[model samples]
Every structure is written in structure tokens, then in C-alpha cells.
Target: MVLAFLTTFLATRFVTHAIRSGRGPFRDASVGGVHVHHEVYGIFLLLGSGTAEFAYRPGGGWGSLLAVLFGAGAALTLDEFALWLHLEDVYWSREGRSSVDAVLIALVIGVLLLIGANPFDADRSAGEGVVALTLLVNLCAALVAILKGRVVLGVVGVFVPLVAVLAALRLARPTSPWARRRYPAGSRRAARSRQRFPPGRRNRWDALVDLFASVPHGTRPRTATPTEPDPEHTR
Candidate 1:
């Protein structure tokens, strides 16, 4: 899975850059006088591969090939996910950065799974009762972390239960639902959380993603404003 993901991700990035810079023979697809986004083909490929995998249960080489197709489809579809969300072409906009973040997240989870990190610890030597208890505790911690909007911590904590407990106990992100509903206005905890995880702090994560996506500065779409008529013309 990791190999497939990286292969597709890198290949897509290369092709996208080549097309954008006019260095490759590749060009944008169009059909019936309408420009077509790769995500459309990606969606179809995902559906077909998924159905084939589920119905026929291909094995060995065929299974590996299907997995590659699935990963490629996922990368393509997610690359333009922001466009689908906002119903506009924001591919190079700040909003499109969410897609990069999403891909990074998927890559992290895939790597973790490949490394044999079990969140449930079911494979351990503990008895059934102990394992059940541990699972219950970890589940609660995971839920708390998620509710507090610590998604990365929550996800990683599943593999390391202690991490979840620590994250859940920490103050929630200021703009998270947990903070909005629970942290009263002007409260000390709210202030502290805001200070610790300020909106500006997201720049660090954004920078990491920029290393991959290389978004140009000042390309975000601006809101339109109504124009005023000239006073002399109105008179």
C-alpha cells in the first residue's frame, strides 16, 4: 500500500507539473466541448477496482495491480477534492492546501500500518479480559482526542494509547468545536489554548505541505465588491 501510494503521488505530481509548465506532450482532457478534470476518471477507476476486488477477490499479482489502481485513483480524486467542496477551481489557491494535508495524513496512516503498529494491541500476550479492558480504555481516549479536535494525536494515539490520553487531557484547539461549546468567552483556559495553538501556528504545517505542493503566493481568489457609479455620470 505504501509503495502504491508513493508511486501514484509522485507520478501525479510529476505529470501535473509537466503539463503546467508545458514541458511534456501531455495536455488537459476535454470531452463534448467541456474540460474534464482527472478526478472524474479517478472516481470511475476507484469504483471499478473496488468492485472487482470485492466481487472476484483477486489474488497475488492481480490483487497487487488492483491495489495500485486504487491508490492512483485515490491520489487523483483527492488532488481536486477542494474544487468539489467549494464548487470552484481553486487548485492553486490556499483552500487547495487541504488536499495536500489530506494526502499527507493518508500517507502517515499507511506508513504506520505498514510498520506493524497495532492500535488495539490484540496480538499481544495479554488475556482476553485484559485486552478487552485495554481496548475500552483506548477507545475512550481516542474519542476524547477526536472530540477535542486533536485529529493527528487521536490517530497516532490509537497505536500508542498513552499518547491519546495525554492529548485528550490537553486543552483543545481554540477554534475546535470542543472549545467553542465548552470554553467560555474570556476564560483563562480559552486564552491559554488560543495562545498555545494560535491560528498562525498552522503556518508550520502549511509550510511542510508547501514543500510538496509548492503553492504560489498571493493566488487566493479575492471576494468581489460592488462598484460605485461616478457622481457626475449619475447627475
Candidate 2:
């Protein structure tokens, strides 16, 4: 499943890059003069695969096939995640960076699970009630982390409870929901948060994002004619 998702993501990015440059034969898919986004196909694939799995409950190779289909569908859908997120085509825009982030998070989590990161498993030495309480506490910490805008940490912390507690105890991002509610204007923590995370500060994560999801304002290799619609603005 991971392999399928990774392959589809790479292929989709390559095709989109080609369309942006008008270099390869790859062009945007359309139907009856209306632009057809790849997510539409992904939605169908997801539905089909899901229905088949539930109804048939196949095993072995059949189950593997369905998983592959589901993974591919997920990749296609997530590639345009920023589009659905903003209810507009944000592809090639700064907002589109979220799509890459989402894909990476999902990929990392999936790999972690495949490699045996099971938070649900409890130690035999610990009582069930203790395990349940611990799980609840970890979940609350995770929620706090997410609200604090430590999204990657919050999500990953679900599989590693210590990370959740650490994230919960940290300062919230200036624009995060937690900060907006708790860190009033001119507050010390608010100022500290801003100071730590200065605006327009390009970090390693930003560089990684730009490497995979370059925006129109960046150094994207494209030179569309004035008469033609800028490919950067299209899917």
C-alpha cells in the first residue's frame, strides 16, 4: 500500500510539473469543456475499493489488491488536498504547501504503523484500567498539541505518547487556535511565540516543502504566453 501511494504521488507530481512547463505530452484532464480534477477519479476509486472490501471481505492477494487501490486513491485525492481545503484551486500557490505536508504526514504514519508502532497494545503487567487512563491522557495531550498548531507532532504523538505530552507543554504558534484564545495581544507567550517563529523565516521544513511543492512566486520552471492561461493557476 505504501509503495502504491508513493508511486502515484511521484507520478502525479511529474505530470503536474510537465503540464506547468508545457514540455511533456501530459495535459490537464477535462470533460465537456469543464476541467476534471484528478480528485474526482480518486473519489470513485475510494468508493469502489471500499465497497468491494466490505461486501466481499476477500483475503490474501485479493485483499492486497484492494489495499493497493485504496492507497492509489488516497494519493490522488491528497495531491489536490489544498483545493478541497480552501474550496478553491490553490495548486501552485503557497496554500498548496498543505497538500505536501498532508501526504508526508500520512506516509510517515503509515510507515511507522507498518514497522510496528502500536499505541493500542498494552503491557500485560499494567491493568486494563490503568492502560485506558493512560490512553485517555495521551489523547488529551495530543489534542492540545494539535490545537497549539504542532500538527505534525500532535499526529505523530498518537503513536508515541511522550511526544504528545511534550507538545502539549510547549508554546503554541502565534496563529494557532490555542494562541488566539489564550495568548492575547502583547502577551508574553504570544511575543515569545512570534519571536521564536518569526514571519517569513525560512526553515528546513520550508525548504523541504518548496523542493516538493513549488509555488508560482518561487523559481518554478514555467513561461506561459500572455494569450494563454498560466498553467501555474490551473490543475
Top lDDT: which candidate number? 2
Q: lDDT per prediction?
A: 0.74, 0.84
Lowest-lDDT window of 10 residues in candidate 1? 226-235
Candidate 1 lDDT for residue 181: 90
lDDT tens readout by residue for model 1, 142-212: 77887888877887887778998999898898888889999999999899988988876865666778876
Per-residue CA lDDT of candidate 2, range 168-200, in tens? 999998889999999999989899999987888
Pairs of colliding residues, candidate 1: none
Candidate number with greatest TM-score: 2
**Stretches of candidate 2 exceeding 4 Å from the true structure:** 123-125, 216-233
